[model samples]
Target: MKNVNYINESKEVFDVIVIGSGITGGWAAKEFCEKGFKTLMVERGRVVEHRKDYIAEGKGPWDFPNRTKVDNLLVEEQYKIQKQCYAFHDGTKHFFGNDRDLPYNTKKGTEFSWIRANQLGGKSLLWHRQSYRLSDFDFAANKADGHGNDWPIRYKDLAPWYDYVEKFVGISGNYDNLPQLPNSQFLPPFEMNAPERAFSQQMASDFPDKPVIISRCAHLTEPQKIHVELGRMKCMARNECQKGCSFGAYFSTQSTTLPAAARTGNLHIAPNSVVESLIYDEATNRLKGVRVIDNDNLSQREYFGKLVFLCASTIGSTQILLNSKTNKFKNGLANSSGVLGKYLMDHNYNARTTADIDGFEDEYYIGRRPASLYVPNFHYEPTRYHKNFIRGYALAGGAYREDWQSYGYTDGLGINFKEKLMHPGQWKIGLQAQGEMLANRDNQMTLHATKKDKWGIPQIQFDVSWSDNEKRMMESSVEVASKMFEKAGFKNIQGQATERPPGIAIHEVGTARMGRDAKDSVLNGYNQSHDIPNLFVTDGASFASSAVVNPSLTFMALTARAVDYAVKEVKNRRL
Candidate 1:
């Protein structure tokens, strides 16, 4: 047994307690500290500084021990769940999670791959950085289909915040006049290669609304004065972003948010502080403080705050609320709606298809671009009709020539194979579909009655799976990809089904959703817990519906908006 010393001393507190130092938490800390609030950020993992901790970011492919190979030991031990991701490897293994240390359960008939990174910067350091905003199509999805509760806020409410964050973060993309995928405040968009440019022109003529455009990524195409002063530089175009960007060219908590917060002189961060639960005061009907377990010394402590921001990832924030059992809220802390752990959703990416293009033998790209082109969703428009599904899917792909890795079956001599691989091969075009998933009551998470983790906390058991709606959407996705390739005059094309389970998209959302009615929602329109005035959840956990677009950009906007409301409420003495 470890030393369980309880340090119940003075109540030295802050104006705000931001839990989990990930993307959203970092934003909350920066906003609150910049607004002159004494903010404390509690992170459950080791602190990793910006340029110094990213040792592997500058390494080349030949410099690695196994030539950037995947280690069998990692696959056997740590990456059983992380293998579902595209960027998991030995060189970047430290950024991912170890499945052995944290374990959860899934229903017997369902499959789920919960990829996580419990670190200082969290998954933001290893994210793809594809920043996009959901349009009115997404905001009105629930009301259109009657799937789940409607989003209390719409695009007009979030558009200003989106612009605010995008300007600071530096998104890069073309300004296409598309309704679904709106353009953002951008730096210079990354240019497409010769073959890719040709494909884009062809697709533009073939399909009207579905224009193929450059990926709107959160990378510094041209670092500004503020970025350079912060020791960040332009992207080197290495495409090894998962190892962590030493140039600070991409937007991570370490590169952008935390540094900004630290400069305010009002931010105090405590890394390796595992938050156990939020302390609720029944007499006051508000959150009083938060209980934390120090990870290094196995000691417990409490910190009081005027406001609490729960930006711990989707499932993590829900677990904290469920563990906070109190007499006032017998079921769970601030779970008056009985929707705390229900309607868990993730974008279904298992319906993707990959194929090879036969032409463009003489064309190739220059440097490694960090993004690919995207084909906007083109299903179930007001004019267009689909027999099976209501919502649609988006397509994103890139053009790449064959490399030396394709010489596995060659019987030729080593030098011959190496020489033959010098020039690029035929251009291969691949497409992946990100389909929207409906919020269902059956897809939920609950605390297990018998299981516990190393920290002696109750483990979470997931009862999540795709329904008939997802199956039909996936079938349509395959057929649509095949038709597009056929129209493009490609040969020997093949479509493969991605074997990923639920939660593998890393876009996990809606465990504690928001709505207008308190009976069906955990949070209000402002992301404040209706049962507890001082508590706010602005992470993906507060989303009422799952949109087809990426959710991180929205999370940033919502966090900024929620902090604004929280600060105002505190000033008014409502919290």
Candidate 2:
């Protein structure tokens, strides 16, 4: 809620500058501020205060003029790309960026939906909140398949950081002891309804390799002293989280990290300051500062910092790096490896299946449970290799009886329909597959040559597509899901093997990957730029591959770990 205008303050160099205010940015700011560094967090969007700025929170469907639906005219004009996302609606549309304002081009035959949320909290306030830890299977995946750069740091290096982040964020889930999906330091898991329990039992019996459990989420199931000190409480199970949780029940930059960072007093937030590029000092062989563009006034300014952390989203960070060109680095800053905008990846999650349960009419859930059921990747082990595909996919779903609202689609007379509406319908179950997308060099994003945005930054152009492996994996997902539904004795089973174009999953990663060799990658194991020692990129841009899981948790772990390394290197004068 505290906005600091750096332009009015003395032009003194800060200890650290974090160029983003999203998930990783928030973490970086908190870590840096708590370490007693004078940290400045530069956010391109408007400041959104926790609880106070959630304009749509707690609003019911009937509260809106058009119910929960966004106007068709607005969608056609400003939200053509954003509307493709599943979360975009009347209540949450304010969080999404307008496609018309943030225009980008795609290849002739391929399409990449660049979903963006530019606000104080960024996508952290709008994410699905599903948090899962990546395993050695993901770390060793690139080496095993020779797809992308081999991850320099394995699961062991990140496990402790994951625990640290999970403890602070208050993840809620049970420990299943699955190697593929490591357990987090969690609060108690939410209870499942009768239908979900039955589905889990059937899945365990029929598909022993695939274990169904409660999906891990960043919700305060049981608020601890740390949470209470931050003015947060336990989740109320309202499930209208995308609108923002006024109760601070969910894990978001506004709800958690922003407040923690603010409490440190070393934190300084500069909102509406869009980063144009980094300022490189050839003499010092380091980044001197950052060039910032005022989002509204179109005026330019520069802020100096000893260390720079690029916590912007994958594409956002890449764009800033590519624009920060110097005489020594003709192509881009820290892009001597020529792999900056290549190896782009996203999760393939279009394939899905649904079925109707015969019974459970009497059963009903009390409140809106935010988390879903999760089935870990069964084909993650080396022994369980797919002939058609190299990687695996995870399944997220749940079973619930249809409520009275579902009666709108049923055929009935007035009296009969009124009577039937009193009773809930049969339980229905669904499973959506989230397959790992291989890191492909051709699936790239670059800046448009001729086009520039309002702030004089080049428009991003995307050329990404799904390969045969992804298509085959999607087919397998539908087939396996249908088989599971059939084995579970469900009726009217339906499945889909289709895959949406890249970026629909909102899990876009890679572009500036990490590896041991600087020739093939942009960053090192510590997320430090191979070319610029004092610069760090701790967001998804440093991912070597897009593992089959929601990536926010992994991003947080990587950011925390990178912060520790950066701080140590700075103190030791190694950077």
Candidate 3:
């Protein structure tokens, strides 16, 4: 990175300070800087330059000492929580936070896996990349069911932002035209294999309402002028994205927004700056600045800005807000509503079902497809009295021919074994459920009375857990998925539920949620804090509900939109 971009020990007050350089942070920085605002993006970890820092992108299995599997001892000691993530392995372990260094507790008898990727890029380097837009179905879900506070803004409010962000991010998806999952500004969608096409063909006959479509994602299927201008290329279908995509094929902090922000010459980056709290000015009733701790030396410093945008992932941002207890608002800054760290939510993804296919021996896909097939929510019966669950879930999976990893355990010798490994294993269909967890006040996180991290920041104690509504949703999702495959004439079908905790979904969102009322929510319609004029949170922390689809897309859209609004507000001299 240019030295100009790295602002260390700076006393100059910036136009904007964006905390967390993940999805939303990158967008906030990019949007603010491009709009002629001097922005300082604060990251609590080391800088990861794009292309240069993608250390594991092209390595083969032989390159790893343990054949790309993380060492057991290292995993057992430092990655106990991170190992639960699907993408954690030898190739990608460097991007993940060491569990030993980051400690927090959950309530006894309940578990929430708080996966951390505390690097410059944050979880954007480690996300699944499944991007979907939320409709009125999701925005009004709380109001329709009375489960949680109603979202202050609806789908129409975010649609234009989604269009703006998607055009730059390059989403690859079919315009399925489903009301539940609105279409994006799409690149060409990836093709489904023979069996998946067969499954899609038969789904309409079995379940008429549910839309079975190719999952939307942030991968660049076909590079557009905007993407090409940034040196991004088309998706190679490598699917080794968790290791990092140097090609900039997917939307990530490194791949897209960070570079966009850098080119404008208005963005400053502060790596290894752990935010301790927000400095509140009691007399002015605004945030004076941010209190930061150096990640390595434990030295303390402060960064002042006219506006503060908290894009720190759900838990990280909540910690800052809760820890920033001011004399004016004793609990936390902009936390007068007392809802800063309540209503913690994650997708309930504990249900899974897989089945064997008898034939299609000649059929296969090109280069291990990256995207999955999706079954949109089928059980959202608002008018009628239902029994299984209140909210809904979507199932995502695909049929693929297994490689050596699936059958490598079998005993073999010499050339015969080598020849067998070259051949693909039997085809199989796998599906898993991702359901919405209601925003119950009980599912929450609180600052521990005594426990603090090495930087003297209070550790978040998660009291979040799945309720019966989630369990019922899982059961129903599995049944529907199994029946879909069964009706498709697949053989050796096996369907069962899983006993996994929250955060394994890697989509844990909510804590400082957006709502209509100032008394019950932290953020307003434009992601501005309800109490503080210059404070905004645009990451998943501001999510009112954990909608079934992947949330990174919406997080990006909200961040861009929030920055737009904040810039205008500042120009108008209102903030």
Best candidate per lDDT, number? 2
Pick by TM-score: 1 or 2, better one: 2
TM of each candidate vs. truth:
0.95, 0.98, 0.98
- Give per-residue CA lDDT, model 1, range 1-575, as digits (tens): 01111132337678998998888999999899899998888888877877778778778878888877767786778678887687887678787878898889988988888888888889998888998998987887788767789999898999999998988888888899788888898889999887678778887888676778898999999988878877778987888889998788999998888888888778877777888889888888878788888777768888888789999999999999999999878778889899999999999887666667777776766678988988877763434436777777788888787766655555667777778878666667788888888888889999899998777778899998887777777777777777777777766677765556888889999998999999999999889998888899999999988888889999999999999888888788767
lDDT of 1: 0.83
lDDT for each residue of candidate 2 in 130-197, tens digit (9 for 90 to 100):
99999999999889877777999999999999999998999999989998999899899999899889
Which TM-score value belongs to model 3? 0.98
Worst 10 residues of 3 by lDDT: 378-387
What candidate 3 gets wrong by more than 4 Å, as runs, is: 2-4, 384-386, 411-419
* Candidates in order: C-alpha RMSD to true structure: 3.4, 1.3, 1.4
In model 1, pairs of residues that clash are: none
Error of 2 at 109 (Å): 1.1
lDDT of 3 by residue, 130-236 (tens): 99998888898888888888999999999999999999999999989877788899999999989888888888778778667898888999999999988899889
How much is 569 displaced in model 2, in angstroms? 1.0
Worst 10 residues of 2 by lDDT: 1-10
The Cα error of candidate 3 at residue 20, in Å, is 0.8
